[model samples]
Target: MKITVILCYAMFLGACLSFLGGCASGKSSASRVEVTPFSCVLAPDTNGSVCVDVVFRVPSQYLSRRSRLIIVPQLLLDGKLSEELTPLVVDAPIYAKKMYRRKVVQNYQDPYDAYTGKVEGVSGGLELPYRETLTIPLGVHTGCVQAIVTEDGCGGCTGLDTVEVASVRNLASLIQDTFELVRMEPTFHEGKVEVLLQFLINRHEIRSDLGNNRSQLKKLAGSLRPILADTLTRVGDFRIYGMASADGSRAFNTTLARKRAESLREWLLKELDIHPELYTRMVVDSRPEGWLPVYQAMVDDGHPDSLFVGQILRRYPGSDDDVQEQYIRRLSCWKDICSRYLQKDRKIECAYTYTSYESVLATDGMWIPFPIKQMEANNQAILCLRRGQFEKAVDLLKDFVHYTPATMNTLAVGHFRKGDVKSAEKLLRKVKLPEAFRNLGVLMALQGKWYEAYRFLKGSGSLNEAVVALILSYNEEAEAIMAELSDQSPLAEYVRALVTSRLGDDVAFEVHLKNACQLDELRLRAAGEPDFEKYREDKIFREIVK
Candidate 1:
């Protein structure tokens, strides 16, 4: 009986050792947890989240029947824990049964019970695959994903292990945080001038001494002098209309008017020494003065018969000159009208149209050709600012007499570009110009105050505004603003590339990025840009950056 009992105890001890050995083998860390794609990307999602994809695998027979495996995925930024993801609990048969009885029979609740997945029959014989996409708020530059696994008995914890499943590196280089500059637009203007001269009743030749003709001619010459002298001015439309009195026959007056107009044109060509090409642009025409001037002169003189003459003139509306002159001849005031107002009708009228150009300072500090009448100090300063000559712009604007809102805004931009933030802010605060708002937005964006910048930049239709939208992750808004930009500059193309990149239009991103890299500065920038990091291996992207 004693030998039999001893043998039974040894057999029971062997069984206990076997069960413990099975649990011990499950605790071995070698190949217990397998994470595919050890190197991962923590990329920005269109929904404004930083996300990573991971697949967690457990080898067959990795779990013991009496134990459970608790897997907790975590995100670490710069070696510190940043975010904890949902825990995935894999329950072996015995532990799963205990958990079920605890919930159903004992009315017990475990906080992590909701995340548990049951493995039927023997737990160590089945493999477990947990695939997840972990997401966190944007702003983490570098990080890694790790899984914390705990193997526990039905009643208590047994073994704990932590493994780095994936890693994120070199992410800080992806950010594009530069602010864009806004340029001042050029101004345009058109002007018209007129000159009038009187002539003798039967003469077509110009008389310098007739009816203040010398002073009038001098004034006309003065107006044309600047336009003719200035290379920027373009003479557009010019007209010379010669007038004749109603007293003359229509045929004779027509001839006299033509001669008068021709005489004036020839005199101008001679006096101004206008080029032959310019002379060809002048238009000389003639028309009979009819009785309107006589009527007007009568009214001005307060003649008693003026009303009667006006009635006679109006009575022959649209009639031939002969019919109108015949009606006026019978009037009692006809003699006086011909002697006084008839002279007034014999005159030359001139109208001139001209266009002047204004010089524009391009972004590269080069002057774009047009014509500038004269560069005002403030305007010059504005050009300097656009050209990135910040100090010169500030100096030019320092003693300026006019403190208009536009000038103030321009001065602020200069100050801002020169790193004088306080002065820029102070100057901007004093003005209510739309340009000031845009500059203020740039300031806000530079300081990382994205929401404030967006408020000021909204609808400003500027590249700076578009960049702020991009920084704020408003991809659609940024793309819309970028698309509306009329500027086809390299900087504009660069911004378009960024917007399209975030919007997931790889085709457009490649096209724009290629165009933008025409400039060496943007090319260098794209090489290190985090936004384009995903495309770093692409043939076209590599070629562009290279």
Candidate 2:
């Protein structure tokens, strides 16, 4: 009995020793965590977030069958963790941002877009070779880390790494941040052409016509053709305006101006058949030419309607104010010469003839082509897209997109024009577009795409664009525009009210239109508006619109 009892006790002691040894020699530390293709975050925004885009590179050192990702993003200020955080998911380029510049993001490139981040599942496993994007809004000073593989009970990802964080933010660094890959802004601006023609100017002086100009022009136009085509595929109304330098005598300057306009026009006709630069800031009408009080006021302010008109008549550049008669006489003499040539249908080179806006419109304007050759090379990419050539279109479009990020309508237009309307619509639905889309709404309406017009218009700016689009897109004319008008702001409210009343919900429109006429600005725009033709003829409409 004693021997049996001793044997039992020895067996129990052996079992306890085995259990203690197992606990002492644990393998948790040796439990390796390998995250490959991982991107390290050097800086995070004020929102306390940084995106992690590491791929789960299979460990060659050890089989990763039992391993998980161990992310160690640092804390910003207060004690915080990225465990509960979620970043914005997208497919575009990333931009790093601070709190101050978001207000003027359009003018400034989207700093967030310049940034690139990756998105992965939350403590969940994803199939290999997956692509994802995560937008991590910054808090004061924290970075974010997400695991693609599940680690329900693992403590490897619990704390931050002990390392100093370095950050840079100056103009140069900011520029680098904005265009890390490349800049597409020039894909639309003429800056590309200017850059290619860098040899045309001797530092700042325009050289006496260079011979390399032809070679440069050909390369530039050809290189930019696909670019321009893509740009135009994304825009509307190639408005073009030409300006002359402040130099030369009235006649010489006038002739030079005409030549410049003609030259530009010829270039457009030769290259871009439909693409054109938009013209801006044309001097239009003002209150009637003469009122004694207003006239005197103008004269006192160094401007008189007659004098202003006369200066224009004399073909005088506004740069000089002294010796009006001397300039006028020279203009008169030059004008007579130009008139004779005009009467005989004769031609005179630039640097000889004096001209006016009216005169130019009658002659040189006729020869000015619609799309300059320089412009055509940049536009006309829709040919392939409209023919259902998506891969070709996407290739060209992507290159274009890499250059100009704001031209979202390029994809939309290309897809729509290509008979892939569903794809076009779907593509636009993916991102929150800028208010620039307002212009696209009007453009669509101009193209007779009423459905797209309505869609784009309805999705434009909050107050102003919405009101304008409502009136413009409404079935009727002035009714809808009139309805939104208020007496407080005649120009804004009344125009809207008129449109609303004439075209949209009449009851709501007429009530507002009448209120608009009670204000001054509405009365002013109505007097000049051609859209009010029918309104002006109807006493009721006229009374309300006016």
Candidate 3:
């Protein structure tokens, strides 16, 4: 059979090849090439070339001896042809005699272009069932692009097929990181104390208002006045527990305990003379017998008889309360135990919660003052810090502007937040405070000095420290610090996902990342984090980070 071709290039249209059905040459004209639809994946190489991966196939009996099949591919970028991407030639040839029989053959051809462009192909000249991949190196361009592939027979003598390639990009996404600045602010310490007032057995009357006891009562009353005045202190809750010794009948002791609690409340209400208008609610309760003190006293006493007493208390076994009491009282050291351990039990316990006022720097780094002060003096730098204008804060604190350890430290924090780590480190070296260590740790972490960061982060309980610990794979330490945070932000959740991922807990990591992605900022942040690069291709991970 002889192959006849009609070649006509109209605008961008392809050409055609025609073969008469029968000829005496014994070659079948029915053999026609079928170019399967194909696609190209464009990935950028480090040396500034876009990799083009094109996959296509030709049927086994399609290649004829008269026709030389070649695939011509041109890159279309952004709806226009890329001038930098020259046309690539992909070909598969068959010998005429071999068309009648199927045989295994392998061939590789690195086709060279006039433009010196290179195309990578499999080790076979398009063999039968010409399924092959051609990886061509094209000039790099990030614009939306596709390949226009044309299968031509007999070089440009005839055009058999044309197809536009659809594509999926495998470009390496860029990472743009954003850093959060840590604020150096004053901190307040909150604490509570319990006051104990002892009473004679069975007597709820006032007595022993002398020595330290008088001072204690005075302090309680004075503390209440300040709290009520709402000046230096704010009271939270007041609880009075009147506890009685575990001696005598349960009924009598219960009544005695109530009386003692009530008596203490009355004395404070009447004698201290707090304003009647104060809406303070004091929770008053009575405990007729508390076994905690008895048990603790026995453990502390460490006597041979104390062991027997502990055994009796633990092994008494009966559900009857009176029987248990009688069984313990029958011990040989009952009187001594009663006098030593039970004496302190006949008392009114006042547990009051009050918040003392102290000026602490707020999130904006400004001191929340009880009274406003002029800013020209010591507050100018503070104002700059509050507004997160770190450059201004640095300028205001430089040299003669301010000269205290705290001022220097604040300036250091401002410098660190402003990306001036060297200056921050120099400033930190001149100071010796917990804040210095914390800031240094954060600075070190930012610099990727994991071990150094850990060294400074030790014994620190800041959120920044926790995040750094997580980044360094100190899971337990990070968890401990994270647990203490009253506010959990998206960044915190992202850090949690990182920690969970490091711990090999995929379920928890997914759970945490799902929560992190719920916040828009964190989801964007996750996309740029290299820590999750391993999971970037995972379905759930791609969904979350996307």
Candidate 4:
């Protein structure tokens, strides 16, 4: 195949990959290739890491003639400057049209680019990104560019040109990691009380002047006013968490969460003398409704806590108004103590307002500010759920998000535990799952769209669920994944074992299972993970145990 490099005399249309030193290969037919989102990546960015992917298309005709596709990728930042490392290659390409990648690096620089200038070594299937180490800056820089390509074509070929490439944008914000724990520095002095509040629960600073407890509120405010003033003046950083419980309607919880957050904000500004200047960075920790689930999460996750969920649950059981109010107040106080030391981020915004549940729930109740009857249930349910009363909350509310392959397919075990496949399919329709639903390959598989899934998952440049779906699956599609597993072959074998088992192919299953056991040591960290349900039943699986 002749990839005619239609360059106007080596102008280099944004750094290109030239074929090998060949005499034009007998001037063959036009070889076509395509690339998407043109960036090459190194490793997995599942945690705090970063990733890059480049999409390029190559002729299917020359594919069988070679065993692999050789791709040389480069990194560029701030327009013209290249990364510390210039070019590298990945052996076998997985997708002819697109490539996916993950990266691991710590950077303070801005505007990153992943580019490929050449492609070589061809076989069947997609391609892989070159693996190498490179530094990425974390500053915000716009309009920067980089390229990755298959540069090993006929070097002496007059038609030497870039068939595909990728790019990257270095943004100036840190990823607010979801799994990150509450960052707190403890201080202890004789007779001084230090409180702890997890971001998951009691995220907002609420300001509700209960008519029944107005006197108590005022008195408490007065006593803390001086300390509040000092705390506000010394304020350097803040973390406002938006919280809601699973006890009410999704509509109600959403609104209630926002309002409670404001209530806390108001109290801080008024009695605490906190400056209004720090408003923008004060984000409410947005979470599911109800303090109980949050409290439970903290307890299970081993976060700092003043009281256990069981103790707090005993305080309020949905019927006692006084019990509910007391719990709310104690939680508020604890949050204040924690906030007194919370380091605020200058870039995040804090200016916001929320409508309280009491206010919104009161339709004609003059005592309530935002009046509407149904709104009360959401706020009340959250309280109940926090008190370890899920049954009561469910009676008053409906489940909002669904766990499933389409919803959070990245999380197979969680969804499996929440419900069976039948229920998952139904729930997935409504959940806003990222990437999970945006993939055609995975979707096609659900509808028995095998070939289509292959087209999308195998060739698409971006990291769609379809391409990596094999990592969690074992079907014909999964078999394709093994050939390209590279240094990550053990992972592929384990997945193959699972798929073969699902298909009732015992022979294939055992073979891959053994292969997976050998590699289990490499991934021993995932040993007890519930996600490995498929392997838990096999005897050989026990052999992999450390």
* Model 3: ten consecutive residues of lowest lDDT: 168-177
Pick the winner on TM-score between candidates 1 and 4: 1
TM-score of each: 0.42, 0.19, 0.41, 0.20
Q: Number of clashes in every candidate structure?
A: 3, 70, 3, 92
Give the alpha carbon lDDT tens digit for every residue of 1-546 in model 2.
Answer: 999999999999977874443221222333333344443433322222333444443223221122222223232232234333222222111111221254466465533343323323222333233233333343122233433222211222221222222121110110000000111121233222221122221122212254454564566466445534553333322322223222224444344434443443355455655343421221111111111232244456563233643545356443342333344335434453233311211111111111111111111123222223212222444455446665565545544312222234455555555566566555455424453254455444433344565566563322333333443344343334333534255444554554554454556556656666676545544443433444557667766544
* Collision count of model 4: 92
Residue 386, candidate 3: Cα error in Å is 25
CA deviation > 4 Å runs, candidate 2: 1-378, 382-395, 398-403, 429-436, 439-546
lDDT of the structure predicted as candidate 1: 0.71
User: lDDT: which candidate is best?
Assistant: 1
TM-score of 3: 0.41
Global lDDT scores for all candidate models: 0.71, 0.36, 0.55, 0.40
Can you write out model 4's per-residue Cα lDDT over 1-546, one digit (the tens) per residue?
A: 234555553546423332222222222346544555443323222221234444445554443322223344455443455553344333224332233232224332312234333244554434444333344544322222244333333223222234324333221111111110111122221211111222233334332332223444455455445533543123334544444444335455566566655655565566566556755545554444344554555566565553644466666665433344355446644564234322221111132222222222111222333223334444555455446564564454343232222212322212323334444334334434343333334444444443454554563332222234433343465455544455335555655554566667778866776677675343352243223446666776566544
| 1 or 4, greater by lDDT | 1
lDDT of 1 by residue, 1-546 (tens): 999999999999977875664453335666467676654555433223444556666766566787777888887764578778888887777777888888999899788878988877543354455556655445444456788877776353356677677655332223233333333334434544455677775787888988788887798778777877777667777888777657768878878887888998898898988878889988988877777877888899999998887787788787777887887788887788767776663567777777666655432334546523223555787678668788998887676433555556777777878888899878877766676777777676666566887998899888877877776678899888988899798888988998888778999999999899998877876775657767979998988888
Candidates ranked by TM-score: 1, 3, 4, 2
Candidate 4 worst ten-residue window by lDDT:
174-183
Highest TM-score: give the candidate number.
1
Residue 205, candidate 4: how far off, in angstroms?
A: 51
